[model samples]
Target: MKTFSAKAEEVEHDWYVVDAEGKALGRLASEIAFRLRGKHKPEYTPHVDTGDYIVVVNAEKIGVTGNKEKDKMYHRHTGYIGSLKSVPLGKLRETHPERIIETAVKGMLPKNTLGRNMYKKMKVFVGPEHTHQAQQPKTLDI
Candidate 1:
């Protein structure tokens, strides 16, 4: 039998919604990342984007275990000397909650263009509502 390799046009993508309410940040992110990479599907191909779209809502409600909420720090820098900045996880959840899930899922994906393409399919929202109703996404509990 010939080896099966999925084609780009043959990939069927679906939209899924994940509620981050009271869910652990790492676990939730990993689950979504797996789906985003299509790892859960039997026909997943490494070189192709066989993933589904993900919509994460209520991201601010995601939680951390132990001291991660306080000890964890997110770092960023501007293209200038001594322009680095950092923020604790707690503050980040309050000010930029959507990034909590986004950063986590991004880290779990491949660090390349393929990853970027998959990352773009992940929609994150701070509240419980999203505008992707037209796609009729199915809700997934992480």
Candidate 2:
């Protein structure tokens, strides 16, 4: 049996839509990350970008279990002295719902260049309207 190592040109990508309403944030992210990396495909290759484009809708309604909304912290630094900033999940959700999902999904991906390319394939929108309907994205249940 020949071991499969897929090349970029041979990788076929698809578009998928995921409704985030009432979905657990972490679980949703993990699944999306998996699909984004093409791990669900038989021809998956670790070093190539074999992921699909994921369009996430209803991001504002994504749920967090327990007291995570109040206790969860998102931190960022500006590469300056004492430039750290932190925000609670509740505040982030209100101000930037797409960012909440983006951050979660990004954290689930590999921390490397390939991960960055896969991250670009992910698109998150606050409401139900998305601009990628022309691609006929299949509805994904997560």
Candidate with the greatest lDDT versus the true structure? 2
lDDT per prediction? 0.93, 0.95
Model 1 lDDT, residue 51, Cα: 97
Candidate 1 has an lDDT of: 0.93
C-alpha TM-score for every candidate: 0.97, 0.97
Q: For candidate 1, lDDT tens digit of each residue in 39-59?
A: 899889999999999999999
lDDT of 1 at 36: 96
lDDT (tens digit, per residue) of candidate 2 on 59-128 = 9999999999999999999999999999999999889989999999999999999999999999999899
